[model samples]
Target: MTITTDKFNTEKAPKPVGLYPHARKVGNLLFLSGVGPRQAGTTKIPGVDLDEHGKIASYDIEAQCRSVFDNVRTILEASGASWMDLVDVTVFLTNMDDDFAIYNKVYAEYFADNQPCRTTVEINKLPTPIAIELKCIAALSE
Candidate 1:
């Protein structure tokens, strides 16, 4: 495999619906694709498994946000990396004003000391009306 292709592999991150890989690794760097609150294969948010009635059984922003982190972690693990390798991150939110606290709560749990360069922004819309999306870059070990 090419250097970039080997560093980041689509199979590592969540499946992309368009012309995008979950992440791409180039040399010693790993660039993760933007991740939202969706479950592995479905557009539905992670903590909410809807029934046939389309009614959500449970939906917590904190839970959903943590799930997003979990997805990121999965990608990192796939690339033989981890959150400690993260160098930069960008968070996109559909409703930042409403979800900031919940996002922070979940985020702090995962990023407490291994804080990577990060930014957050309020966007007009997200892929699935999920509260947040995260993309990151990580430096691989030599």
Candidate 2:
């Protein structure tokens, strides 16, 4: 059987920093690209303060967590999926030691109802100034 593939991008979500769609579907799985906390239609990143060098000075992981989750939900819905469809999630944090507990706490609030397989790792940095990003996979019910 031929494999069916489709890509999705939504204007309501933050425009991707690179040349890639927000999410892609191959068969029954929907894969989301790294979603960050940057708000749509603006450069403001929630809870991030930039130094004079345009680098991150201080960031509240809790705020980023909520914003990123909202972005992910936006992409999922735009792609005809829902938050409950997420089956696996991979989180990337620039500073795990300082942010893990806060991020985990905020994450629990959003994911209280849906328990998906999750993995979180500390990374050196991301392409943007945000502190966290999420790469997720969802199993569409349809």
Candidate 3:
């Protein structure tokens, strides 16, 4: 059987900062590109404050977590799936020591009912000013 892959792009979520589509589906799975907390239709990073030089002065990880979850949900719904369909998630944080606790708390709240495999790691930075990003995969109805 020939497998087909389809790309997904939606207006309900932030337009990707790069050329990639928001998600892609192959066979029975939907793979999402890394989704950040930037608000849809704008570059505003929720709960983030930048200094006069435009560097990260402070940020709220809880806000970023909630926003990212919402963005992931939006992408999932737009791609014909839901939050519970997510099977795997990979999170990138710019500061693990400072942000993990808050991020974890918010993550628990969002995922209380749907427990998906998750791995979170710290990176030096993201492409934007956001504190976190998520890469996800979901099982789609066959």
Candidate 4:
């Protein structure tokens, strides 16, 4: 199988925290990193704040959720993939109950045509105060 990475210069996407690109394409699959709403080179999104050491942001759920997905879109474009190529997604939310509606609103935009299989769950924590993080598997060269 062949492998490649997708990178971009978008300020709207979060900077990688380690020795990794935002997404990597292997064979027909683009494996995406888990993403949050934090802007590139910053710890917080515009209207979000850290409540405690491990608490997630209690901001407008829709906006924050949308931001993370937007970052995903950029990464997909960089990988020569698109939302239409998504095959599966796994979402981790610190507040899934509170953010489900917002997630649905934004998720629908990308998943309208070929809805992928998905699973979401509320977790105890995520990186920074971002409410959610999403990891995806997408068709890369299809």
Give all candidate RMSDs, comma-separated: 3.5, 0.8, 0.9, 3.0
Better of 1 and 2 by TM-score: 2
The C-alpha TM-scores of every prediction are: 0.82, 0.97, 0.97, 0.81
Q: Put down candidate 2 lDDT per residue, 49-71, tens digits, no spaces.
A: 99999998888888899999999
Error of 3 at 69 (Å): 0.3
Q: How far in Å is the alpha carbon of 22 misplaced in model 2?
A: 0.2
1 versus 4: better TM-score goes to: 1
Model 3: per-residue Cα lDDT at residue 21: 97
Query: Which RMSD does model 1 reach against the true structure?
Result: 3.5
Worst 10 residues of 1 by lDDT: 4-13
Off by over 4 Å in 3: none
> Native-vs-model 4 lDDT?
0.75
Off by over 4 Å in 4: 1-12, 51-57
Model 1 clashing-pair count: 2
How would you encode candidate 1's per-residue C-alpha lDDT over 37-112 as one tens digit per residue? 6777656576665667765554577877888898899888887888899999999976677788888887888899
- Tens-place lDDT per residue, model 3, 14-121, is 999889999999999999999999899987899999999889999988988999999999999999999999999999999999999889999999999999999999
Error of 1 at 56 (Å): 10
Backbone clashes in model 3, listed as residue pairs: none
Report the alpha-carbon TM-score of model 1 versus the true structure: 0.82
